[model samples]
Target: MWADPNVRAVLVLLAFAAAYVLYALIWPFTHCGACGGGKRTAPQSQGRYWRKCGRCGGTGKKIRLLARMFGRNP
Candidate 1:
């Protein structure tokens, strides 16, 4: 079974999926990519005015996509 290429691929993918789910459950929040968790971003040009991050909406944290899909919202 382990010698088969298809089997190895499937096992690797399954492990990855399991790790992703575990991560989603453990740490459901990730840094705001848009503002780098600073909670502020310039909405207009280069540093014109610091405002709330559009992605995380100023909370500085964004719920993981997997968490949202699993009905986790906080």
Candidate 2:
């Protein structure tokens, strides 16, 4: 019974869902992976000015998708 491919797929999917839910509860916010949690962009060769991060809007934080579903807004 446990060897069934269809059953195994469903179980794997359920496990992933459960893990994501737990992750959402434990960590509703995550760092800006795009910017490595930095508020500004690296200095470019074209100029020597720093700009705000595009991914995190210079805040260095991002709300998780499930957290938004749970009513935790940015």
Candidate 3:
């Protein structure tokens, strides 16, 4: 029941676990560091425009922390 302390503790634990799992799964597709996630434009004064992201290789996806830690290439 809602009044049970054990139930409340379990619910909190479950919520934290779920959050962690979600973060791990979706952390890879965050954004491109070079392109600023495709939101900003490159400087025109430098005579360069629409260049591909160097870090993410223009795919706009980053390597997940969990994947790198597990020795898997992203």
TM-score result, candidate 1: 0.76
| Candidates, ranked, TM-score | 1, 2, 3
Kindly list the per-residue Cα lDDT of model 3 for residues 41-65, writing each as its tens digit: 4577364446666677666667667
lDDT of 2 by residue, 1-74 (tens): 89999999999999999999889878889888877776344556353327677788777789999988988785
Candidate 1 pairs with clashing backbones: none
Worst 10 residues of 2 by lDDT: 40-49
- Steric clashes per prediction: 0, 0, 0
- Cα-based TM-score, every candidate: 0.76, 0.66, 0.45
Distance from true position, residue 52, model 1, in Å?
Answer: 1.7
lDDT of 3 at 5: 100
TM-score: the better of candidates 2 and 3: 2
lDDT-wise, the better of 1 and 3 is 1
On a 0 to 100 scale, what is the lDDT of residue 39 in model 1? 40
Off by over 4 Å in 2: 39-51, 54-57
Q: Alpha-carbon error at 29 in model 2, in Å?
A: 1.0
Cα error, residue 9 of model 3, in Å, equals 11
In order, the Cα lDDT scores of the candidates are 0.83, 0.80, 0.68
